[model samples]
Target: MMLENSKYLFDRAQKFIPGGVNSPARAFKSVGGTPVFFDKAKGSILTDVDGKDYIDYVGSWGPMILGHAYEPVIKAVQETAAHSTSFGAPTEIEVEMAELVKRMVPGVDKIRMVNSGTEACMSAIRVARGYTGRDKIIKFEGNYHGHGDSFLIKAGSGALTLGSPSSPGVTKGTAKDTLVADYNDLHSVKELLNTHKDEVAAIIVEPVAGNMGCIPPAPGFLNGLRDLCDAHDTVLIFDEVMTGFRVAKGGAQERYGVTTDLVTYGKIIGAGLPVGAFGGKKAVMDVVSPVGPVYQAGTLSGNPLAMAAGFALLSELQDKPVHYDQLEEKTTYLFNGLKKVFDKWDVPVHINRVGSMISVFFTDEEVVNYQTANTTDKELFRDFFHEMLQRGIYLPPSPFESWFLANSLTQDMIDKTVAAADKSIEAALESSKVDSK
Candidate 1:
């Protein structure tokens, strides 16, 4: 594909925006080459600034589960914007959105809205500390809970893609309190709890771990965490920023049949808008401001526009329970297609998928945790990503990130994506052979 416009724009963007992109992943550093600037997106396709159209699989990092520029969400935003945007006061729409969330999510009784996933996670931890009266917290190595100062230690996704899991500027005091554990390894967490004991406030995790390429908890991992937390009086937190509403109606807590004391939500909840929320049992949530002592606030926390879009999206989801079924079928179809195609070429790739979230790791070893996920042949993945891009497919620009499937993708779109992967697999194979020689 020609990239005259995109290339020109990227050059200009670099002069103004650091590294020519607002987000690190958009720089395409992990996948190689300049990032394609999108002009518009509709349903399952993204059109680049240069007029090149490609099947979109990233889905705006999981918020576009209903697909880009969904009619209901767009219309709701438009209609709500006309009524005035941010009042900085309480709104009925906010209550409606909260009600919908409480009804859909398994354990939430009261929710506090935040501006982004990062804020939601950061504030949730503070609430857990205040509720439990403990200081230390345990987080998994690869499960990113957004860029809260504490979470930046051994984080995944954009942090890992940029070659720095431990970002600088985070204080030593913050890092000391944030203990690291391995994902899918109950023993690791057990060891942390054994050492920290009563000092641990909460154990937070990405229930389906989309940041490190969609690694699900090994069989009994989540259950084990719940048990450990209960025994130790530690709060269990599910960071469902990516999995909430995408994996299941009640999020990972429902999908995995596990209930957490607190859950953080983002992405899909906003219906592609910038919104996030955290909530749990009423007792714990009452600790938040206005109701209790722990304070947190945001000007656009429950903005009318965000509430309207989210309400429309959730209403459609709740009304049409078949949306989940359709997503699973489509995802399975694509998963099986990729598996068959890669196996036929004798490629040793492990694809991890749960619900609509998935990722193809360029490794023969099973990717159950951060260590295994890091063993992927990143150069091979870069080649595969570029090849897919050339074939009119827009994948997550980083090897570590998961590919999110939107409900708007048709069977034809999935088939086209599989076809592109078939070609891309061969390209990756050739590149591997050349590197080995």
Candidate 2:
């Protein structure tokens, strides 16, 4: 629990690296603390710079599904690196990876590899616009599809209106092309579609929302989107960067039984490496360059190292369906344990989960969308987060991100986590009472 070294690193990182962290969230601005710098991780245990070990639930934000330092993934990366990393052209592993994805995923007939989820999404939207000859797209609120300019948009005063740029760099022109809709609300989407008519080229969603704390699609929501897309002749894109292989072998589309026109993937595909892809119905993907007019290219698009690691990891998941089931069991154990603790404390919390992805919101209201998800008591969560960290349990630093459980977690580790939660809650509640006093 002694984070002296972490504190030192943070100070140095701030002077050299902006905010001492590459990512804004990692700066611990939300949770108000020093972010622990990790030295190494094995299985479910993370060894911080000071050598403090905590059971990991972040799972590198959802790519280390099988766990950190997993032999297969590590071995694949090492072996592939021996043959040199980037070819800048074509390789057999990339083809194997794409073929595997097409086989495992439901609707992907042809796929194109990209460097990151943002690239995949950006490319996909371009393709949708090219194919449909339209310039606008609709995206659900609170869905994080990376830092793509188009994705960084805020709802403009009301639903059924053009969005405004959330970030300073994004132009009004970019924002105007993106429309924001309410998650889990088909009425909002229908309203936008009606207003926009054939102007919208595509609709992108996070299928199982992770950014606004793991909100699942409402009943018939995905199907509703499917029908609407078909009716409008608009392409539907599921940004499965988080849910791709983590929810199920086939992802949210398979889990919900609703397929999309195009799907973008990241996270699990690279086995924690920086890789992403977009693919779906052959007719639509055929619009991309080398085959069609739409141009999307990356020098390191199919980096051999990432492809090798991804293929190795995905092949395991494909061969052993039990990994997903075991992950579900472990996640359920944690969820139920946390629920019991909260119930015993008479603390009303909203826990939304889809398969292994889950989030704990400090609110009694059902977290069906971003607005409801915002009702969470931030102070309470911040207190709980610090207490959990002190007790060797690492949760996502923010209340809005999902806690990804790795199957590497054992029953003992889970029990220990529950016990930690019990004590942590008691201490956190006491702190809250003192702060109020």
Error of 2 at 433 (Å): 0.6
lDDT of 1 by residue, 1-437 (tens): 58899999999998999999987867788877888998999999999988889999999899888899999999999998998989999999999999999889888999998988999999999999999999999999988988889899999999988889998899999999999999999998999999887999999999999988989878989999999999999999999999998899888898889999999988678887888999999989999998899999998898788889889998888889899999999999999999999899988889999999999997889999999999998988888898999999999998899999999999999999999999998987898799899
- Superpose all Cα atoms of candidate 1 onto the true structure and report the RMSD in Å to 1 decimal: 1.0
The CA lDDT of each predicted structure is 0.91, 0.89
**Every model's TM-score:** 0.98, 0.97
Q: Which residue pairs show backbone clashes in model 1?
A: none
Give the range where candidate 2 is weakest over 10 consecutive residues by summed lDDT. 156-165
lDDT of 1: 0.91
Name the top lDDT candidate.
1
Quote the lDDT for 48 in model 2.
97
